[model samples]
Every structure is written in C-alpha cells, then in structure tokens.
Target: MENAFLNSLVVGAVLLGCAVFSALAGDPDALFDFIVPPGVMPANVSANNFTFRATKADFVAGKLIVQKISLAELPTLDGAGVSMATLMFPPSVADPVHFHQRASELLQVTSGSLFVSFIDSLGRRFDQKLFAGDAFLFPKGMLHYQINLDPKKPAHAVAVFGSSNPGIVLLGPTLFGSGLNVEVLHQSFNISKETIEKLVAANTPHPL
Candidate 1:
C-alpha cells in the first residue's frame, strides 16, 4: 500500500504539478483544479463566519453528477482538515479507477449498494460489496474504483476526506485521454496497437 501510494504520488506530480502550481498562483485559466488547498482564508464575507451549509446542488451540475465539497465550496473548511463528496450511481454505472493525491477516503453508503475495490502496493486487490450504512476506507493515493451493481435502483454514497482538499486522478483519463504518448502506453502495458487505439478512442474526451 505504501509503495502504491508513493507511485501514485509520482504519477500525479508528473501529470498535475502544473495544476498545483496554477492553483497556488490563482491562475483562472487552469484546465481544472488540482486542489482548492486549505489554509487560505476567504475574504470580503459578512461578519458571520460561524457556519456554512452545503447540499448536493452546491457541488453537482445536473442529474449526472459526482460531486465534492472542499475549501472551494465552503471556505470555513479552510484549516478544518476535512471535506465531503458524494457518489450517485445510476444502475450499472461505474465510477472507475481513480485515486486521491492528498488524503485517505472514508466512504459510507447512504442508499442502495455498490461494490468497491482498491489495489495495494504488492498488487493485492482488496474489495467489498457494501450495502447502505456500510463504510470502506481507501488510503491516500491508492488506485481504487466503485460500481453500482444493481439492475434497478440507483446507489449513493458519501465520502469524507482527511484533507480539506483532496484531488482526484483518474486512470482512464490519465492513460488514454490525457495526451500521454501512444508508444509509451503501448510499451508499458505490452498491449497491441489496435487495442491501445481502441481504448484511447473510447476514453477520448469531448467538450460539453
């Protein structure tokens, strides 16, 4: 697990180091936020700095959503060492392989159920089927994924992170859609060119 975490950090740094720099520099042109890092206080708000509230809408876009609330959503969370996110899975939908660069995740099912798994340093996979009220932990930087296996009802889970801002690194996007060279992927996975091109095509991103 430790080694896996370290490897993930290296990959994240290689891919997203500029994202981190841009966020710190407050560059609005960043492709996406790597982290809304904590400890920076919010400015120009009303005197009432006592509390904050957030609902799914605060973090979600539409019916199709996987959302998180960090310092970006609630400035009060700055320095609080905590953040929350939600996973809403339509039946048979997958929230595929991904990792958090900064914090461990503790996720609790709130509706329906899902199967979750993580791969450790030694390549040993740990997985579980969780029903509502069940919880699982994935240590920081461990590659992991979740799937809603049900055929009918939707599933939902809530996750809490140990850091105020935990950024995600997704495997599919990183490998197939992020513009990593084809030769590198072909050699690393030792897969055929046809298969590689198919995966790249499947994962290619299109603007909304």
Candidate 2:
C-alpha cells in the first residue's frame, strides 16, 4: 500500500510539471493567472506650450501655415528614448534655415510637394525634391530646411527625432528676435529695419 501511495505521488508531480511547462510555452497574452489589467493612460508631466499661426491668410490664397510641435512634453517609453511632431507648411512657404544641435531626425513626407537642400560649412551643396512618399534623414547639427514647392497645394510631413525632448532652437527667433538688437541683425543679414520688423512680426506668437 505504501509503494502504491508513492507511485501516485510521483505521477501527480509529473502532471504538475507538464502543466507548468505548457503554461510557459503557450501564447504570452494568455499566460496571466487572472485577467490582466488594461494598459495605463499616458500622463502629462509637463504643460505644453501653445503658439498661434503668424498669419491669418494661410487659408486664403498665397500664404503659409507653419506649425511647430515641441517634443519635450511627449511621453517616454521604458527602453526607447524619443518623441516627435508633425510640421506642416502651406504652399509656397519655406521653413527657416535651421539645424538640430543635439538630436538627429528622420523626415518623411506624407502629402503634397517638398523641396529640401543641404549646405555644408565649406559651401558644398546637395538637394532633393520629395513628393507624397519620400523620406530623408538629417544628421545631428547639420543645417537644413523644407520648402513647399507646390504652387497650389499644401505640404505635410512628420519628423521623428532620436531624443525624447528634441528642443528647437529656432534660428530667427533665437538670433534675431531677442538675442541681438535690430542694428546687429541688419548688419549681419544685410536687410533693412522694415524687412526685419516684417519678418519678426510674421513669427507666430510662441512661448517665452
């Protein structure tokens, strides 16, 4: 009778081991002992800045709508460290010549026409005209800009950055608006005060 009991115990242990292995090997989603809780909602740890478009005539006829989205307020994943925003430029408008000092970026065009050009410190040059489904990568600290070449339509694109909060150091706003006075800017860019005022005034109201 004792041997019989020992045999029964051995069989029960074997069954338990098989069950454990089966559970582990099966679909990962079904591995939870009880129905797992749903995913958590994204948290807003910081307040996002708001800026209005510089021009109201963007929708009228011959103006541009440039939307700036800052990546700093976006949520971060555990292993991946990045955030992004879509920038839209209306027809015939141009993004200011700029550079991302710290973060590299991948810009993928989704609609309309886009013209991008590259310029090096030594005056070397290269450029490409992208349509609805083209993508390009701009390395960190390299200067670049996107222009809407379409004569009658708008252009849209998404920019993916390598950092969670890819800060934008806007060239015009940073250099011309606050840092240097009108006299300095006039000397640097070889433009008149009227032109400077018009350009500065065209800038969308941004966070201070």
Q: lDDT values of the candidates?
A: 0.77, 0.65
Q: Mark the 10 consecutive residues where model 2 has the least summed lDDT.
A: 44-53
Q: In model 2, which regions exceed 4 Å deviation?
A: 1-71, 77-79, 190-208
Error of 2 at 28 (Å): 30
Model 1 residue runs over 4 Å out of place are 1-64, 205-208
RMSD of each: 11.2, 16.5
Which residue pairs does candidate 1 place in steric collision?
A: 1-121
Candidate 2 to truth, TM = 0.57
Evaluate residue 192 in candidate 1 and report its C-alpha lDDT on the 0 to 100 scale.
90
59-173, model 2: which lDDT tens digit per residue?
A: 5455455344343332222223354667677778887777776567788899987998766777776688998889988766677888998777888888887654455566666
- Candidate 1 lDDT over residue span 101-123, tens digit each: 87789999999999999998899
- TM per candidate: 0.70, 0.57
